[model samples]
Target: MKQIVTHADPDLDAIVSAWIAQDFLFQAHASEVLFVSRKVPEKFMQSADCLVDVGNRYEPENYRFDHKPPAFENRNSTCATRLIWEYLLDIGVAVRHLEGLVEITYQGDTHRNSEALKQSRIDGPHAKLKQLKAEYKDPTEIYQQMAFWLRSYTKNL
Candidate 1:
């Protein structure tokens, strides 16, 4: 199985991004897209092709931002959500329907620069994970109501 992996205790961005990636993979990869939200088990990382996130604690080349220029890192302090959305857009996924979701959550990234987010207070409680549960009304319902908002260019990613 191919893996769409996120950092340990994945936050909102990581979880949402992983779900989006899974949807995109369904359009391409034939096998199941395993959403690895914690440190990837060795079996998956070693046996499967892995796509990882900014907080990826895994040491692997599939990492998307390992060699980002220092300036870029400074400007965009967090990864996962923003990176995933941009990657989806770049790869031609239908994420034109989800841009707003990406931006609203990015604010949490700035908060991450200074504080330690916790589940009760996690690392990126916004960027990092605290628990796994549904936080939206319903994705299908959301898409129906806000597809236009996401498609519009309020600001650049």
Candidate 2:
């Protein structure tokens, strides 16, 4: 089974990146998602099939996607979600249905002040994410719920 690792108490980017990996990258294959600390443990670093948003590394060929400093300092407008999404497209995966999802994720990660973002902050996915964070202490539960929501969301987009 493929093992995907991301940060615990995952934010939008981390959850969405992992979701993309599970739903697209590993489609038709069994996979497990693990949530770790911001400083990913060396165990996961060595054993995880994919590391997203928390590895501090951005080597797509290696399936390690992160936009943190030291490795991706110039990727100010991109986040882990965008990297994984682009990787899917590069690998010939169909993700045209996800363009809006990816764009909103990028906007949120980069803190772009747009009317849509502002409205989302008020009562959209962003608001739902915040509500989920406040309600659930378990990261896995949060990811599961968000993954379900994202699956439904993309079908509509």
Candidate 3:
């Protein structure tokens, strides 16, 4: 299936990055995929199969390319990650949370808090995650806890 992504601004990078990772997973499974974005940077363009510019069209209703209706929405300060996460969930992609973060890995690869873990000695959030890890024997349990937290987090938004 062709996956079209529309970017309104640079802030959507993280969501786009996660989608790229998901594309990689799909490609590994021998699925055909395409990425379409407006005003995409050179770095991102290199990774995309097709690129289009929607120019000054802020209204999601006015957007249409390849004859497909655009899936557009305003994102929180985190940009499109939350919207992307919600879309993935709606589509039935199984995502598990880890330490209050959403993670989706089709292969053995996983999202790690390596940097956060290292910074834990200084940062409060990382320190809390570190403490949680210390208290739990199974890392999977942490993911479960994160899933619950994500539900609460999204609900309050």
Candidate 4:
């Protein structure tokens, strides 16, 4: 099975990037989501098929997507989710419809205030994510729930 690794207590960027990797990158195969520390261990660095929002790496050719410096010197404009989404698009994946999702994730990750993002926090995926975080202790559960919700959101969009 393919493994998509990310930091524990994953935020929107990590969860969304991992979700994209699972639902799009490895759509034809089974993938496991593994939560590790922000400082990813050497074992996972070498073993995981993809690392998202962690590992401090942004080499998409190697399937590692992260926006934290020094991986990204200027993180104000991008995040892990956007990096992964763009990579998928480059590979001819049908993900143009997810541009909105990618934009919101970028805004949240970069702490950019926007009317659309603010509205989303009121009742959109952002709201659901906050609720899920409060309701679940396991990060994996939160990711799974959000992944399901994202899949639905994508389909309906």
Candidate 5:
């Protein structure tokens, strides 16, 4: 396997990486691609292989930011995560069964600068897990729910 790291804003990086991963899967004719990240963009759900949330806490440093629930119409972060998981599962990717943490290393060292170091700290996957747990009795059930949804969505596609 080959890895290509690029310098881009967080959101852009997520999109580009997801896209590249999708292309890799197509080129390699792989069953699925696993996307490991602390936070994944909403737009990448269409092409993701597996959306893995490695961090035990969603935003360890910024829990306050995610404490408040968004409006009913607003997107729920955990739901978004489940959506990607479901999308992949529908296409026959056994993502939920996979066990491991996803790690992403930044391309350059920014710790030398205090401001850069501060900017580097952001939320992790744990936040999404917490939110999902609050909504569902068992977080593991999300996998079944996602699989069901995937089954429905892929029928037409």
Candidate 6:
């Protein structure tokens, strides 16, 4: 089994990142995958063949790298969504499918502060995500819908 491990105590951002990474693996590698959302033991991290979202953190010795940009490489960006999206993009995954998620994370990490939200111009994508979050709808619903689509798409290929 392939395990995609999220950061310890993952939030929505982490979950969304995991969802995308999971899909990328399914399409590019194989469909049998599981995402581990808990605080994974270092023992498990060392032992399993897993993809991890360990941002600005230590790299597990055994897992082969598909693509992981170093933290110093992109200081302006926060959150795993951008990192995961960029990695997928490099590997030829159509991450436009995840624009909504990508956007909201940008908003949450950048403009979510009181001062930034007060500014007249939030970036268009982030602004749209802000509006979506305002509606009190679960963001997971969108990713779930995409997961279904990606599964069928992968199987067809």
Clashing pairs in 3: none
Q: Kindly report which residue stretches of model 3 are placed more than 4 angstroms away from their true locations once superposed.
A: 1-16, 23-27, 30-38, 41-78, 102-157
Between candidates 2 and 6, which one is better according to lDDT?
Answer: 2
The candidate that achieves the highest lDDT relative to the unseen native structure: 4
Whole-model Cα lDDT per candidate?
Answer: 0.45, 0.87, 0.34, 0.91, 0.30, 0.49
State the TM-score for model 1. 0.50
Write model 1 residue lDDT over 44-135, tens digit each, in one string. Answer: 55565544453333333343421123415453465565665676677676667665555555655545432223321342223222222233
Kindly list the per-residue Cα lDDT of model 3 for residues 40-80, writing each as its tens digit.
Answer: 55554444432222222222222121111233332112223
The predicted structure with the larger TM-score, 3 or 5, is 3
lDDT of 5 by residue, 1-157 (tens): 3321211222312332233233322346543323333443444332333332221222222211111123123332232233333444456654543111111112111112243323333322223333444666632353334333434433443
Query: In candidate 3, how many Å is residue 142 off?
Result: 26
- Candidate with top TM-score is 4
TM-score to true structure, per model? 0.50, 0.94, 0.30, 0.97, 0.25, 0.51
- Give lDDT tens digits, candidate 6, residues 70-153: 533543345566656766677676776665556555556544544433341364333433444565355354334445644554
Q: How do these models rank on lDDT, best leading?
A: 4, 2, 6, 1, 3, 5
RMSD of candidate 2 to the truth, in angstroms, is 1.3
Model 2 off-target regions past 4 Å? none
Give candidate 4 regions above 4 Å deviation: none
Candidate 6 local accuracy as lDDT? 0.49
Error of 6 at 26 (Å): 2.8
| Higher-ranked by TM-score: 1 or 3 | 1
lDDT of 4: 0.91
